[model samples]
Target: MRRSPWATLAVLAFAQFIVVLDVTIVNVALPDIQTDLHFSAENLQWVISAYTLLFGGFLLLGGRMADLLGSRRVFVIGLALFGAMSLLAGLATSPGMLIGARAVQGLGGALLSPAALSILTVTFPHGRQRNIAMGVWGGLAGLGGTLGVVAGGLLVDSLDWRWVFFVNVPIVAVITVITPVFVRHVAAARAGDRAFDAAGAALGTTGLLAVVYGVVRAEPAGWSSPEVIGFLAAGVILLAAFVRVEARAKAPLVPLGLFRSRALSTSSIALGLNGAAFLSMFFLTSLYLQQVRGDSALAAGVHFLPMGGAAIAAAVLSTPLIQRFGTQRVQLGGAALGVAGLFLLMTADAHGGYATALLPGLLLFGTGIIGVGVPAQISAVVDVQRHEAGAASGVVTAFYQVGGALGLAIVTTLSLSRTNAAVAEGASHQQSLVDGFHRGLLIAAIVAAVNIAVTLASPQLTPDAELIAEAAAVA
Candidate 1:
């Protein structure tokens, strides 16, 4: 049976959407999860961090698996694992069980996400088709984050918080069943191919997990604390070791040569910085709306509709902009807009209304993210060889996850410290929270400025004729 390209794109895009949605869907339901499971405030954070840590850590190994085992096979297996874990998470009666399930869910996402992207990269030609697909993919990616908050609120308010996990069951089932029909199966690795580097996988995964764990804990334990310092140092050493292993291994988990492509390397860095700005914006805004503005979860979610609309519009607009201006220029322009947006957000006060203070910033920030994000994604994979597509996708995604985690940790710690100081000096609770948020936004603005500078300094990336021809042949 033959499948339409659009159908294939839809299936893959939906898979990516659900995987990304899980990242933020649980946020709005956290309070409910904590109360139902009797989780302490400190431990509650683990509910989010556990999933993020494993998802970020195991991505490389997962991408390698997609290359060795067929993308279709690995994708199906990931879906099965993710669905099973989601069921387990929904049924959990204890905090331990839920966290464990979430971690496994993260691993499932690690396997599924890059495999989906790899399939898209190979299935779509590298010119207009791929660009449009990427625009759709990027649009859904942004929409998923916004939608998760809305969906979480709706599910929690209308039914139960557990429904957030349960929601994945039907979606996964539908996709799993239809995927084989739509996505063609690729040939798996030959039996005599190079051996898998077990050492590299172990070191890389552990190193990432350690680093993410330290960052996540930094909010509660100060950055100077022994626990934070020890974990961060160990993670760095392990990562250095992984690099050495990769350099010498017969079949490395990641090929160091992939970095030779300036486009991929620079785009990866740009994506990381963009991730930092985007994630912090979401985190701080959600807190500001609920804690300072006293909006209900449902109300806060609804309020984000404007941001989501803006992102979708920008996603649609990005393809033409890239065609006209090139990826480098569009990306830099987007980062500049993000800086402006963050600076505008810095002016928000405790007494400000959404229309007056939040709407303009959210609009610009949402538009800015889609501008940067879609182009960077295209740039990461457009010049890579077919065989290396999964690894490149994984690297880009890993940077995104790691960058967001690190940025959120830094900004959260700084904001909370400032908030505490303001409280000590007799500021109202609302005012103190706003003050901290301002400081965090200012830091985020500086990060965006850095992104703009980096983009300007990097060499412009044009589409390679050979790469486009190769991708066209594959498609």
Candidate 2:
């Protein structure tokens, strides 16, 4: 059965938007939720991190499941679970209930995200059609993050915080109804014999959760504490074991050999680094605007409009630049822009004017992310076999989510360190917050710069460059 590419794209894109939307939507409402739920300061991040930890941890399994099960079946199942969990999240009466629901929601997201991408992978075969479809996919993913901040602020101000979760139901419902008519079902891969790698899945998920838990807890407890060290050590050993198991498994959750592709390997690193910086940008910036500048959530959302617009523009510009200069050049340039943006952001003071200090940095950051993200994503899955695309896409998404987990942990730790130092030195709360933000921004900037250097050094682009060189040799 034939599927309308348009309808399939819409379904997948919308699904992705919901998945990515959750990442930023909660940020604008964090303060409100805290006040109402009596959330402890340390526990505040878990509201977001819980979702990320589960989503990131299980993404590989989800991708593999899509490969084992049918994509259409997985898509529908994932959508239903996510929608139901979203509703549950909206109705939560306690912090534990909310966090539990969020973890479930992330589980649903883990299922849906890879399925959505797999659908896209199958719907558009290779060449121009696939490229165009991927562009839309990439664009929507970035757009979703920007829109989340805007939508979260609007909903929080106009109605209630619960509306953010409730909003997904209508969108998911619409897609659920339309997808069957528009998309065709594909059979599962090797349906009879292969059992899902339950043991591997357990080890991988537990390992990641422990690592993310330790990272997020760093700010609350000093890094040297036994608890932090224990969690980190256990996570590392478990993950190493998971890797070893994957090497020998008959059907590994993530194919260890996929990393053999230069394109895939470099792309994953680039995306991970891009995510590390990009994910933290909004959290830090929004906090600065609301806490220091005293902007309302709505006002902060509006303030981000330029950044959003710049990002959209940058994504639009990426295709042409990538075609002309190639992925390597474009990515390197984008990373440099990100570094510059972070440097500019660090120049902002508590009293700094928005126009002179803030907007420029926001614009640069937005542009950098768009430029890096799209190309990096394209490179990641470009070389994989058709059957392996789902697994490849899952790996890319996992890198992205884990990057967020790590980025948040680092930023939180730095913020706490700076804040503590300021307090010990007799600075006011507002002043300490400013100091923390400044330090965080600087650290993020340094990270971005290192990513830029790493991207420049990546061995993948060397092949493409060699291809060009060989062509010249023949000429």
Q: RMSD for each model, in Å, please?
A: 3.4, 4.3
Q: TM-scores of all models? A: 0.87, 0.90
Alpha-carbon local distance difference test for all models: 0.79, 0.78
Model 1, 29-136: lDDT tens digits are 776787899985445556776787678767877777887888889999998899999999999999999999998999899888777877877788767788678657
Give model 2 RMSD, 1 decimal. Answer: 4.3
TM-score of 1: 0.87
Worst 10 residues of 1 by lDDT: 466-475
Segments of candidate 1 deviating more than 4 angstroms: 1-10, 34-46, 92-97, 118-142, 177-185, 382-390, 462-475
